[model samples]
Every structure is written in C-alpha cells, then in structure tokens.
Target: MSIFKPRRKMVVNREVQYDVLMYVGVFIVALFIVQVFTAYLFLDQVQRVVGTMSALEFIARYKISFLVYQIIPVSFSLIVGVYIFNRLTSRIAGPLFNMRRILQKARNGELETAEIKLRENDYFQEEINDINVILKRKSD
Candidate 1:
C-alpha cells in the first residue's frame, strides 16, 4: 500500500505540516543540547584520567576529534528521527486535512464527496470507510 497521495489543488490549509515540523524541531534541539552537555561531561572525566594533561593540551590534541565522533552519532540520529516521524505524522495529517474538506462539502449536501477514498495504505482508511457509511445513510 502507498503512503502518499497527490494533494488536491484546493489546499484547505497550507500549514498542515506546521505542527509536525514544530514538534520535530523542538525534539531535535533538545536532543542536541543534551548530547553536547553529556559529551562535555565525558570530556571532564577524560581530563581527570589524563592527570598531567592540561585542558589546553587535551583540547589541542583530542577535543575536536572526540566531539566530532560524539556529535556525528547525535546528528545522524536526529536526522533519522525527524525523517521517520515526519513521514508518520504526515500520513495521519494529510488524510485528516483532505477528510475535512470532504466532510465540509458533505455538510453542504454534496454527499458525493463522501465517495472519495484516501490512498491505499494511507492512515485512517478504516475510520474513513465508516464515515462513508454514515454519509451514505445521511444521503438516503
């Protein structure tokens, strides 16, 4: 089953993705802040272990390399997290946005709009099918 359908020309709301993006952005920022904090704390432990190594020496010799290694994983994970959830949330939100249009049309006595089904494998297909049944009853 497909996860995406071509959006209609009549966009009821262009900001359909805004909530997902905001949440994803917030999460990514929080994750990055935490990652940076932990990496520096780990650096402190490293410095303690080095005993005779001055902070300037440690930084000049190893700080950039260590932080790069730490940050690489965090960045990769953040990207993957945003990608996965954006796809997931979009699946739900797109249908909802389209369904709102259909339902609104039905409210104006255009029962034919209820016959429009979402794409295969799209989120909320079953619930929409039930809504179609209700629309059929209302039309009758």
Candidate 2:
C-alpha cells in the first residue's frame, strides 16, 4: 500500500474555503492598493527632486516598468498565498468534516460498523480515537 494518499478534492467545505479565500482576497486587494499608492508618492517625490519631467510624462515613461517590477511579483505572491491557504484550510476542514459525519452516525446509533478513520497527516487523531473507543464500547 502507498504510504501517501493524495486528497482527491481540493475543497472539503465550500463555505469555509470561500470565506477564507474572500478574506485573503480582500487583504491582498488592500495591500496592492496601498503599495501602488506608496509607489506613486515616491515617484512623485523623485520627479520633484529631479525637476526635469512632468508628472504625466514620468508616468507615461515608466508605466511599463512599474507593471514589470511591481504588479507581476505581487500577482505571483497572491497566487502562491491562495494555494498555500487552500491546502492549509483543507487539512483542517477535511478532518472536521469526517468527524462530524462519524459523530452523527454514532448519535443515530448507526455506528456499529463505523470507525473514525482519518488521513495520516490529519489533525484531531487523539480526540477521534477517544470517541471511537467510546462508540465501540457502547456498541459492544
């Protein structure tokens, strides 16, 4: 048997995953706005010090450079952040989802053949194991 089993689904809970992603999305948007504003202020200061280029001229000349240097890196970081958060949230959500189902089965007295089986890397193993022991005894 393979020691590692990949998760078939990226999302275990839609509400939870979307909520997390939404918060992250909001934060990223705010961060990007602040960064762009700061960059613009710095560029304006530089133009004043140089006293050669008008604001419009400076922006027109360096817009491509700003996109290349700033937007691309921020976009890449946001992509990576979303991926990492999705995986991290899935690890927590997957175990909770399983636990809820298993506990519900126990409550309904349909746990005779049920066991709380979790992935190797999953959280809450100890808690689930304790519940399993109690359910096994009750069924016995």
Candidate 3:
C-alpha cells in the first residue's frame, strides 16, 4: 500500500552495487531539489530587479507554461523516485520475502531438500550459502 510497507520488508544487508545505486538515486533527488530552489531564487531576484508590476505581468503571461516546467520535473522526480525506490527495494526485498515464506514453510517442516534459489538480479549470495551450509549440516 505504501513505500513504508516495502521499507519494512527491505533487506538491511544489501549488495554493494545496490547500495551505490540507491545512494546515487537519493543524491540526484537532492541535487534536483537544490536546482529547483536555485531557480526560484534567480526568478525572485529577476522579479525584484524588474519591479513588481512588470514581474507580475510576465508571470501572468507565462504562468501556466512556467508552472508546468517547474512542476514537471518535481512530479517526475516524485514518480520516478517512487518507482526506482520501489524497484530497488523490490530487488532486495523480494528475495528476502521469498526466503521468509520459505522459512515459514521450513518451520512447518514442509521444505523441499533443494537449495533455496534467488533471482538472478537479487543479492544475498553469502546469506544463501550460509543457509545451504546450515541445511547440509542439518541433513548430515
């Protein structure tokens, strides 16, 4: 229902590649917000220098278009940010989610003997190996 839902499921120990991409995405969002603020400041200064009525006239003339330009990027950032974060989180969370469900089955003593598989794009190979090791030890 929300990003918060995925947040709860998101694996704490993610691969380095995922960490890098996630941080980079966050940095871009921050950079974009800063750019927007800087643009606002520049526009404000231009309006002040040009005098209020003239600035008001200019804004009135191009208000719709100007607003669209500003809104589009932020709206895109919001949409793309949610999408990227969702995907990024999913790549991490999905494996863990699968593992959790499998673990639940294992707890019920209904697990298959085959090693738990991860998606090609997913992480936690080390954890998977560890799980397999435990299973091997248990079987012996």
Candidate 4:
C-alpha cells in the first residue's frame, strides 16, 4: 500500500486576482477613453476656431492629415495599453498559481515540508509559514 496519500484537488485563488485585474483594467480603459475623448473634443474645438467646420471638409482639405493627426497615435496607444494590462494580470496571477500548486502537493502528502519562499512583506506569508510549521511538526 502506498504510504503517501494523493491530493484530491486544489482550487486556484482566482477571486483576488480577478477582482484586482478587473479594477485595474476598468481604470485603465476609463483613463484611455477619457484621454481620447478629451483630445477629440479639443481637436474639434481647435478645428472649428480655425474654420475647419466639418470633418469631411477637413479630411478632404488635408490628405492623410486626419489619419496622421489622430488615428495612428490613438490606435498605437490603445494597443500598448492592452499589452500592459495583459502583463499586469499575468504577474498578479503568478503567485496564486504557485500557491495552488504547492497546496495540491501538500494535500497529496507529497509535500512533507511546506518551505515555499514568500516575500518578506507578503500579506499571506504568515499563513503560509504557519502551515509550513504545522506540516514540519506533523512530519517529525
């Protein structure tokens, strides 16, 4: 008979990760939208002051001008924002993924010592260390 019991399951800590990412994503999107809208409004006002009353008139009057002035920069900035948010979310999810994997091993009795290194100021460090101590004592 096998001495070490297998772990049944371990749930990843999704709530904190999802909530934080959602808030950050929303804030970034809101900021980007606000900036774009503000720029559009400012440009429209400036164009009106300069007698470029209509978008069609303006675009026709200036070849590649509209695209050069607005479309390219906004599109590029939005793409960069998306890439940043993706990386941010991945970073936030990484620790949770590691913790879940370790917990799974612990559950399976494969982890006789829970010696996962946590950050010195990490909020969950205490909990993890406590669990590690308990596991160590139990093993001894």
The candidate that wins on TM-score is 3
Cα lDDT for residue 132, candidate 4: 70
> For model 1, how big is the CA root-mean-square deviation?
11.1
Per-residue lDDT of candidate 3, residues 53-128 (tens digit): 6756877766775666677666766776677667767777777887787677776778656356788887776887
Task: Quote each prediction's TM-score.
Answer: 0.57, 0.60, 0.64, 0.50
RMSD from true fold, candidate 2:
11.5
**Runs in model 3 with CA error above 4 Å?**
1-53, 112-114
Lowest lDDT block of 10, candidate 1: 11-20
User: For every candidate structure, what is the RMSD over all alpha carbons to the true structure, in angstroms?
Assistant: 11.1, 11.5, 7.8, 9.8
- Cα lDDT tens digits for candidate 1, 14-72: 44456556767877787788687767767776765577877788778787768776787
Compute the lDDT of residue 31 as modeled in candidate 2.
64
Model 4 agreement with the true structure over 1-140: per-residue lDDT tens digits: 99999987753545545666686778678667856775686577556446635767665665455556567667676777678666666655555576778778878888777555655433345556776787677667
Q: Alpha-carbon error at 36 in model 4, in Å? A: 5.5
Which residue pairs in model 2 clash with each other?
none
Model 1 gets an lDDT of: 0.74
lDDT of 2: 0.74
